[model samples]
Target: MFLGTGGMTPGHQLAERDDRKTAWAWYRGRAVRDLANGYTMKRVYR
Candidate 1:
């Protein structure tokens, strides 16, 4: 869905995607991976 990026700055608030929690979770995981390493993703269980 071409999600945008986020940071301590403004103009990027992802929390608005409350209707698509799965998309938000995946996006969050990717963002976390971008900031760190060794991120292993399993099928979403929640």
Candidate 2:
């Protein structure tokens, strides 16, 4: 799933795979090491 901030701005992306598992944040058009302070994310189990 993809979450956009602005009308046409890039935002966070989440994907699930059996072989790969990790959370990532993106800014502008590049992958970031970490998000800014006060930002947080929670994982939901299905």
> Best candidate, TM-score-wise?
1
* Per-model tally of clashing residue pairs: 0, 0
- Write the residue-wise lDDT of candidate 1 on 1-46 in tens digits: 3354645224334444454787879999998886665333233332
Model 2's number of clashes is 0
The residue-by-residue lDDT of candidate 2 on 1-46, one tens digit each, is 4345554333232234421343222242243324422144423321
TM-score for each model:
0.38, 0.12
Off by over 4 Å in 1: 1-19, 37-46
lDDT of 1 at 3: 58
Off by over 4 Å in 2: 1-11, 14-20, 23-46
lDDT of 2 at 27: 43
Candidate 1 achieves a global lDDT of 0.57
lDDT of each: 0.57, 0.34
